[model samples]
Every structure is written in structure tokens, then in C-alpha cells.
Target: MPLFRRRRSATPVPAPGPTPPPPSRRSTEELAAAEAHLSDFARSRPGVEAFIEPRTAVTDTTVVFVAASGEWTRRRVRSPQQAHALARALGVPAYDAGVVGYPQRMREWTRRRAEEDKRRLDGG
Candidate 1:
């Protein structure tokens, strides 16, 4: 007589837990504070050119600044109003990068700056 072995059945897996709620968005005052910080930084930094770009999708908004030698920085803002105010404080023009697009001069400056960095890295 041949002995028969019984196979054990697979256990059912449990469903995933509920997702947590998303973080609350920042208030206008908080956005203003961030703008002020950026504005101050740009003013203190030599040769910085500030620009604002409106966000389309999930991002709130953005303000970007490029220095004379093309080093750059960017931050998310709450609204266009805040961006304009920040630019005014920094004494630099703000534009919608999506609409007006990035300036040709800025692009050229960035390219040249990158080349310079490469040269420095290569010990030229």
C-alpha cells in the first residue's frame, strides 16, 4: 500500500491599512515669510537675478534666482502675488517662466558658467 501525504492550504493575506491624510497646506503668512527669506538672501548675495515661475500641477509655485556667474537657487511659493512682492523687494524683475520663458541671456550665462566649472574641475 502506498502512503498518501496531504498538502497544507495557503493562508489568505490581510488587506493594506488605511492611508494617512495629506499634510495641510501652508498659509499666506507662512508663504510671505519664505518670500522674505529668499528676498533677503538675494539682496545679500552679489549679482543675483531673481525670477518667478508659476507652477502648474502638484507644485505650489516657484521663485528662482541666478547669480551673475550663473549659480542658482529655487524655492516653492504659495502664489504669484507673493512671488511679485518678493521680486520687488529684491529689486529684480519677476516673470512667468512658463509664459515668457527663461531669457536667452540667462541660458547663455548658465552654459558659460558650466564650462568654467568644468575647466576648474579639470585643472585647466
Candidate 2:
């Protein structure tokens, strides 16, 4: 004889909401354009490094380049592997943004740019 009896509910559990569609893949032309842009940036900037960002529900995989001056640019790529390959082709070291995070110089540059913009707005 069981000391306690389990109670069962007749109602069924509700289903979860619809899932979001994944980000669309880029066309060949788009990929080429992105590659060209990255190449140009790498060629023009000194001490540039690549940082690969993982794909998310809203965005595809992306690669970011940070130059010595802390100038940066971000562009989407086919995948992390492509990003690393591109970096290698560009002759720059590539790191996982999720692991290493962004460089401090990049933050400093952004802050300086913001300050400059604010000064201009204030007519200084």
C-alpha cells in the first residue's frame, strides 16, 4: 500500500511561443564587398588586429578590426572560420571577441571622439 497517492491534472501544459528566424546568410557579392572593405582597412591601418564576434539570433558572425590609433570597423562574415581566414590573409592576428574582449585603446578612442563631438556641439 502506498502512503501517498500522486494527483494528475487533466489540463495540458501550454506550448512555448514561436521561435525567431535565424539571421539570413550574406550573398557572394556582399561577402566580397565586406572582404574588400576589410582588406582596404587592413592595408591602410598599422598594427591592426581582428576580433571575431559570434553569431546571434539577430546578427550573423562579424569581424572587427582595431588599428593602432584605435579606429575600428565591424563587418559580417560567413562564419568564424571565414573571419579567421580573412585575418590571416590580411596578415593580422585574430582573437575571439567572446574570449579576449575588445581592446582598451578602442574604448579610449570612442571616448575621445565623443568628447570632441560634444565640444564641437558646445561651440568650443
Candidate 3:
């Protein structure tokens, strides 16, 4: 026999709480809004092209519409297929961003915008 016997606890240990649900995806309204925005972009910009960006750990699959002027917009899409379909519907040529890569005009446009922003901020 042991010199000292351990005493049992009067109360039972509590079980772990239930697991929380996973985060929900974008809603129908949100998807519609995204589509509308894309349509609007296509209508307003002359010579717009769609580029599909693959999904990443941080972001969902997205489509980027770049105009001839280099102005662009990006929005999350359900999948690459949907992006291509959207491009077709918009009557704009689509390309895989990973394959051909983004156009140089887009970078130049971004740079010009940044300069314009700086000038405005400085009241120049």
C-alpha cells in the first residue's frame, strides 16, 4: 500500500466547447455587384482586356480589366472559368496573367497616377 492515497475530485472536468463554423463566402448580392462593376468598367473604358489572376492563400481568384489607357480594376471571381466567361460576355479578350503577364502600359499608368496623387497632395 502507498504511504498516502490520492483523493478523487468531487466535480467532473468540463468538456471542450463546440467548434465554430468556417467563414462564409461572398453572398449573391455581392457577386452581382462585382459583375455590375465589371460591366460598368467595360462600358466606360475603350479597349478593355480581362486578365485572370490565380487564387492564392491570401486572396481568391480575381479578374483584372485593364484599359488601353492602362486604367484598371480588379475584383474577386468565383473561378478562372467564370472570369473567362465574363470576358467573353463583355466582348473583351481574356488572358492568363501568369502566362503572358500584365502589360507594360499598366505599370506606366500606375506610376503616372502615383505622380499625379503626389502633386495633388503637395498642392502643386
Candidate 4:
């Protein structure tokens, strides 16, 4: 089942009024806290680059960090523009993950993880 369900209503939907703030996984405070975390990661991690994943119907835009060794982490940001701005401020280059796709090291890391899981399940 979908995480968010729409309710059936007999009343007609109201016309849009004033613009509303964008929905986010974290509150404003939490997003700001996450920004600090990103900054720390960029400073401590080597060759880290930001990959901005576009938002879909289900979620907000996310910034994924791929280090030189392919280790990665992700956190939700308000939008792609914010992602780019934040990344630049941190002195890192940002790219659209959807457009350029993930780096080869990231893919290799995933493959290694899967292989390790299979080995563990097979008791070898």
C-alpha cells in the first residue's frame, strides 16, 4: 500500500490561495541540522561530490554524497536548487544524479555488498 493515501471527498476541491511551504521529511530546524552534518562530511571525507536526486511524487529532493572510495550517504533537501547551493558552499561540485547517473565506484560498492550478503546466507 502507498504510504500516503488520498481520501475520497464529496465536496469540490478548493482553488489555490496563498502559496504553501514545500513538504519535507524534516522540519525547518531538522533540515538545518542536516546541513551541518553535510558540511562535516564534506570536510572530513575525501573527494566527496554531491549528487542531487530530483524529487518525485513520493519524496523530496535528496543530496547523495559519493566519496573517492565510493562510500556514500544521502539526506533530503528542500529542492535541487538548494542542493546545488549547499554543495557549492561546502566547496564541492554538485551534479544531477539522474542526469549523470552514479559513479562506477558506487556501483562496485553495491555489488560487493550483495556478494558479501550472499556469502553469509550460503554459510561460506
Candidate 5:
């Protein structure tokens, strides 16, 4: 070892950068618009039922439309009121799945369709 020579350390030093800002919360109008858009999509699709799923996030609640065959479309809204409004505009019955649970008819239809598809795929 040479005298007055500096030893290099194996540890790496981290470089500092500016912290990112938190995500902005969606406004009520924005949420309502999203709900409307989703409802429109669902209504346009044949045999779809409009359903709402409540959420605790600041982004607002979610609105989903479950088709008779179990296919679904979803979007976020400001509140349940906005969801209902969108449902009415779409002319479909809107419901909270958490409270009412899934409709029996829709479930049965989906099951039958799945079984049929499986059988076809299996060539049985």
C-alpha cells in the first residue's frame, strides 16, 4: 500500500432527486361523466344489466354492468346518486351488488352458457 493513497469504499451513494407530487383526486363532475360513459356503453350492448359497486377511495364509487352471460363493463363515479342518474339515463335498473347480491337469473344464464361452451370445446 502506498502512503497518502485513499482507499475506495464498496458501498454506492444514492443521488437525491425531487419527490413526486401525490395524485390528484377526481372531481364530482368528472366522476359523473365517467359513470355516464360506462352506462352508455352498457346500454348499447344488448342484454346487459347495470350494477354498482361502492368504493371508499377518493376517486369515487364504481359502476358496472353485468351482461346476462356474465360479461361486464365498469367505471368510477362520484357517488351512488350519480350512478343512479346514469342508470336512469340508460333506462336500466341500477343496483348495488353488495346489498342486493347478484341477480339469480343472470347467474343461471351464465352457468348454462359456460357449460355449453365447455362441452363444445371438449367435443362431447
Candidate 6:
């Protein structure tokens, strides 16, 4: 090797094989769980609004339901597209949580719940 010239180390490169199909984000068990939760919410809560959260790098899409009383529930969904479809199928208006912030009613409900819990703990 000449001065100022670096020698390259030998390394074996593995041959590439056929790429596997992308893994599915939604599983059957998860879908079933979501359906059950949604069904219960619909039967119990009248006029529930849906909010669809889009997928991120680490998390899958999810659908949240907000009842008139501010009670809320969420479950994993197949994708953002499916979340919208689910809202339509459920006959509820759907908003994108990523685009618009979470509903005001939801925050209010959470606050009320927290306050109630605190009072109960204090025996008030």
C-alpha cells in the first residue's frame, strides 16, 4: 500500500432473497376486541362521536368514541382509512384527531372524572 492509502478489509455480503410481504398492523383478535367495545358503547351511549387517529411510526391507527356525557373509549383499528369507514358504518361523524384536536367534551369529561375521583378520595 502506498503512503496515505488505506487498505480495505474483506467482508462477505449475503445474497438477498425475495422480500416478505409487509406485516399486517391489525390482527383478528384486536379487531374483535374493537368491535365488542364499539358495540357496547353504541348500545349504552346515545349519539357517540368518533375520532380517528392516524397511524404513526410506532403506533397503529385507533378510533375513539366520545359520548354526550364526555365518556370516551378507544380501540385499535386497521388503518386511518378503515377508521373513517367505521365511523360511516356506525352512522357517526368522524374527525381526524391528528388534524383537529380532541373534542372539547372529551377533555371536560376527563376533568370531571378526575375531580370526582379526588373528592371521593377525600370523602367529600
What local distance difference test score does each model get? 0.73, 0.94, 0.91, 0.88, 0.73, 0.83
How many clashes (backbone atoms < 3 Å, residues ≥3 apart in a chain or on different chains) does model 5 have? 0
Instruction: Estimate the lDDT of model 1.
Output: 0.73
Residue 105 lDDT, candidate 6, scale 0-100: 87
Supply the global lDDT for candidate 3.
0.91
Candidate 5 least-lDDT 10 residues: 19-28
Give me the runs in candidate 3 sitting further than 4 Å from their true place.
1-24
TM-score winner, 4 or 6: 6
* Residue pairs in collision within model 6: none
Count of backbone clashes, every candidate in sequence = 0, 0, 0, 0, 0, 0
Residues 49-77 of candidate 6: C-alpha lDDT, one tens digit per residue? 88888766676778899988889998887
Candidate No. with top lDDT: 2
Quality of model 6 by C-alpha lDDT: 0.83
Clashes of 6: 0
RMSD to the native, candidate 6?
A: 4.2
- Residue 14, model 5: lDDT of 77
Give the worst 10-residue stretch by lDDT in candidate 2: 19-28
Model 4 spans > 4 angstroms off = 1-22, 117-124
Between candidates 5 and 6, the one scoring higher on lDDT is 6
TM-score list, all predictions: 0.56, 0.79, 0.79, 0.73, 0.53, 0.74
lDDT of 3 by residue, 8-123 (tens): 88998789998664353888788789989999999999999999999876788899999999999999888899999999998999999999999998999999999999999999
lDDT by residue (1-124, candidate 1, tens digit) is: 4489766669865789986644538776877677777877687777776677766557767888776656667787866787787777768867777776765667887788889999999999
Residues 17-52, model 4: lDDT tens digits:
987656565899988887888888899989999999
The regions of model 2 sitting more than 4 angstroms off are 1-25
